[model samples]
Target: MSSLTHTTTPANTPVERKATRSAGRRTSPNALLSKGVVNALLIVAAFYTLMPVSWLLFAATKSDRDLFSTSGFALGDFNLFANLHHVFTFNDGIYLRWFGNSILYSVVGSAASTFLCIATGYAFDTYDFKGKEKLFAAVLGGVLVPTTVIQLPMYLLATKVGIVNTYWALLLPALVNPFGVYLARVFSEGYVPNEVLEAARVDGAGELRIFAGISLPMLAPGFMTIFLFSFTASWNNFFGALVMLNDEKLYPVNLGLFMWNSVTQQQPEYYSLVITGSLVAVVPLIVAFVCLQRFWRSGLTAGAVK
Candidate 1:
């Protein structure tokens, strides 16, 4: 029995050592140290990104005097309600008008932009039109060009068309998003199967019917993505609005807040209003993302799959 046991132990010793080494590697101090470092970096990044938002939130609760005097992260007197009342009441409630205009611009403009992008992209994906690639390349080049650079040209064109300083001025330019077209084309290629389209054609479905009845449902996620992108872009657009709008009534929330911020240079009392209004301005965007998070996530995942 002793001789048999000795032989078995010798044979199993190497296997036991190998298993121990693997287990050690998996739970090694170095591996754990690296993981700790990665977690730390992620935390730092999150903190950095959230810091300004946090400061804004805290600042909004303070009075004008407290805004500058109080510690940035510390809460001052709870005057959020008062500040909101002041914001709505100030300048005969022009801020509310600005907010309403922003809503109209973002919702209507983004919907238009999304529809145009999807139609254009679908055409590119499915049709064999002349100059399709060249036209698409031009659109792609537009994406690389900064909006600031084109703003002057667009302003000039708007002047030629006599649409400057009007609702059309903001909405029309917002609708021409090159990147949205690119994304929509990618989504069309991935999500819309050519076989399905061919089958629809075989069934005598018109092009419009195929798109509306079949393709739209499959492209719902993509539509949501493009809408969100366009909405955010339109809502936060300041420079274009600044250039196009001389009328205070036409100003979006961003520009409205900027106007108030500018005034704070002379009248320090406007400081609290600016902070509070800024916080209020951010709420719609947050609400949009939260409400559509499920659709947004699914769309992003579907797009990434291909």
Candidate 2:
């Protein structure tokens, strides 16, 4: 009787094992195919995005004569140093002045913008004031307004104020970043808890003290993100510089590069300088993004969890 029972059990176990194996087999092909397609698309997209950057890097190393003649992907004569030398030494090192202007505009403008955004955002998120919703909606509307559409009017206003050719034109306009305000508002809502603010108040801390001591540290990641965005925007601003700055001394790198490109049409040698200048100009932004990427990611994910 025990042998007969064991035989029946073996038969039941085989049937169960076969059923489980068949279920797994049914799902495996579809799962494998989906994963394969996703990976393939990602690889293709990555190549497409990287191709232009790769060309720029290799193009920067080539001499003017070889730039058009050489294959886009192939390495030409390693003339990167020579090109940089030309870029720096041309017109009494004017490119260096442009670089300096860009740095000043980006750093100072972005810092001011970040501070203002933080203060305003904290107020909007933490306080309930008269017409607060209306004011915020107005700000959101301002964010949707195309910057280029306003550039002409901004330039006209600057011209009327007689600050068009000065650094004020660039710096002043950049300090009022609507997007930075929007981002800061979103970040502050997530980072600065109402309960924490109330607790700080209960502890007899003043509003300013509470913000500085408790909220600012929590908003550091958001501040970094705003700084990066404002800096990049200010650094890469072309139209503002083009319309406002007629003085080459006040021109940022983007405008300076544009001027060089304009000359390239008449003088082919300027092409190399333009390419090299572009490569150099982009390096700082790349370094900035790489260094602050962790902070940026943290800021984006800050309110997502809790």
lDDT of each: 0.91, 0.90
The digit string of per-residue lDDT tens for model 1 on 21-77 reads 999999999999999999999999999988888888999888877887879999989
TM-score each candidate. 0.89, 0.89
lDDT of 2 by residue, 1-306 (tens): 455443344655887999988889778988889989999999999999888778889998898889999898888899989889999999999999999999999999889989999999889888899999999889989988988899999999998999989999999999887788888888998888899999999999999999899999999999999999999889988988988999999999999999889877789998888888888998889899999999999998866876
Residue-level error in angstroms, candidate 2, position 170:
0.9
Error of 2 at 255 (Å): 1.1
- Can you list the residue pairs that collide in candidate 2? none
Off by over 4 Å in 2: 1-27
Best by lDDT: 1
Whole-model lDDT, candidate 2? 0.90
